[model samples]
Target: MENKAINSAYQYAFIGAGNMAQAMMAGLIRQGLAPARIIASTKTVASSEKLTASFGVKAVQDNSLCLDADTIILAVKPQVLKAVLNEIDRQKLQEKLVITVIAGIPAAFYYDLIGSRLRLVRLMPNTPSLIEAGMTGAFAGENCSADDRETAKTLLQGIGQCLWVQTEQGIDYVNAISGSGPAYFYYFIQCIAKKGEALGLSYEDAETLAIQTALGTSQLCLEQSDGNPERLQSLIDQVTSKGGTTIEAIDSFKRNNLSAIVDEAIQACYDRALAIGETYTK
Candidate 1:
């Protein structure tokens, strides 16, 4: 944990004091960003008070106070983001750098809402962000300057790995992949544990085995990987014998068109993200 501060000059305002905001604020503070430079504004006084007490940052119930901050981060849910935006006076935001983490919303949508150009960044971060091991995909609006992108990266890096893409559509793809990926892994782990229990193992023992195996495999991949996809596949191949049980399982997956099924699932998720954006835009 490096204690070096990032862009310490700018004042940061988070519009929602929920788990995602708390996770990001915790990471920033852990990395030595001054708490006094940040403020969180929740819809309720009680929620604002609780966040202030927990994080030692300024908290307010009024969303308009965000206008005074140098950077504004919209952390509200997608369903309510429009209401929050409508509440704000757009004239006050003309010069502000706005970053949004509301899932499925596009930078273009925000641009249309404001009816003017300003620095905006649309980001998609996953559940893993709570542990500071998250992957965030970001896309800066066309009018955003290089410095604006760098600022967005610096803050996002405090919490996890960050990537900037050339196109806004890239963030939608990220929403389908990394954004929903943890749930897929969890479901797979659940299925494995259930099968183990069917084989006479106690539920707890089966879960332990399933989770440990998943964890061990991830660790092994991390150790052997040089940032190459082929390296991971090679490691998997090493443990799969030509006619062993591992091969049997591989064959079964292939017979069931597992790859196609997974691809379709990801495509469906991506389609939904696009649809959500359209819904908000309308």
Candidate 2:
């Protein structure tokens, strides 16, 4: 299971061809990765047929068939991951680079299930990946070589932005922020729309307004920040002028301890991620 030399051109196999798996597959194909080099093993024949029809990739219901590829992507659910791993050929798995997008599982958990020599990378990618605008966090196992990291980065970048964290626990921090982060924004948008509805605007009009505002605001922050945190704060300050309507809303948020509430929510998410990992360890 020790790190071995891998070919620059990889043949990838996905264990479960779900939404996230399909996203990655789409990105890879869009970036010129040959669909013939990709294989997906889904849970059902219908799912397999759907993938083949949509992506022109080979698809099957047999998990064992995936081991023929040099790189394996574990895109299955956390609950079913153990079963999937158990069903795969362990010896073959040891020689391949395995990248897992299943959340709340540590690299050690995989090593324990497979072998310590297994080359593994744990990844957390958000839903935006479907549209190739994902934010992904990656952590490599100790046994992985520099090539393994690069291979992962190359494949991931096709989908969107990729960040490599130094520690495995950093993956949990990622889970708190970007992993569960999309739902938080959606909830905020929903709340805004609901408020507008209460204020006499139609639900459709209110939701459209909120959605556009959110999209424009995100674009503004990204363009203006230029990777500077302080610049982002400055952007916020620019809109919250003294006694302005924006300031009124900002004051109400502050008065209600919105910052602390968000902090608690993120912490809760982080804790739950760690707890899930702990469960697997035990």
Candidate 3:
């Protein structure tokens, strides 16, 4: 990649202006993009006002006026997408790369909705985006040019990590992993916190301990991860002495089939994502 591929075409018009959009816009602005270059539009006048005041970006009430933005982001809820995109003619929504962070809907849906030949990038980004630590998985439509995908990658990278997949189905896989993975980790920590509380720790201490453990584990993975993850797990197992507390805990988890349970839960998420796309057209 050349230095010229840095960043291009500001004037991003965020259609939803909701929490995710705000977080992404925040990440972009934090990366040195000017606030004057952003345009956020939401259905609620108050939302528009709040964003404009908070970010110093231009705001608009209607989708029609949001067209002034060079790159258009469809950030509304999945349920309202049909009605929202219905309001804007497909022909007019063309030219610029249309990126959708909304979950469940495939990139091709946007392409088909806006008529084929329009550039589209569909992304599945989690709530962590609010803090700029988000992990996002993006996929480009067949019609999307390489430049358009790179632009989308550059824009999304401002907030968090991103990786592209050849098939849009990868977004559903992403929905199972990083997108929904955060909540899974949180739920696990929540249970751990509760367990700590049962062991006589104060509620705050229990929560803190559980969260710190999770954070430290994640950081370890980030810092020491090699191509093979089982090696690290083996190292962990070695550190956890034989017939020790760690072994006891590991035995309990294995007895309860924790791995299978987590796998099944992820499959449930993946199935749900596919089902949503199947029903969208109906």
Q: In lDDT terms, which candidate is top?
A: 2
Ranking by lDDT: 2, 1, 3
If both were scored by lDDT, which would come out higher, candidate 1 or candidate 3? 1
lDDT of 1: 0.86
lDDT tens per residue, model 1, 1-282: 342358667789999878878988988787777888898998887887788788889999889988889889999887888788898898778689998888987776787777567789988998889999888999988888988887787778767888787898999888888989999999999999999999999989999999999989887886898888898789979989997989999889999999999999999999998888888777
State how far residue 142 of model 3 sits from its true place (Å).
Answer: 0.8
lDDT of 2 by residue, 175-247 (tens): 9999899999999999999999999999999999999999999988877788777888799898888877998
Clashing pairs in 1: none
Output the lDDT of residue 179, model 1. 89
TM-score for candidate 3, residues paired by index: 0.95
lDDT of each residue in 1-282, candidate 3, tens digit only: 422233545668888988889888887787778888888877787877888889999888878777877789989988898898888756778877789988898666776678777888889888887777898988888888877877787678767788788898898999899998888988889999998999999979999999998888878878777858797887577658887888888888899999999889999999999999888756
User: Which consecutive 10 residues in model 3 have the weakest lDDT in total?
Assistant: 1-10
Clashing pairs in 3: none
Candidate 1, which segments miss by more than 4 Å at Cα? 1-5, 226-229
TM-scores, each model vs. reference: 0.94, 0.95, 0.95
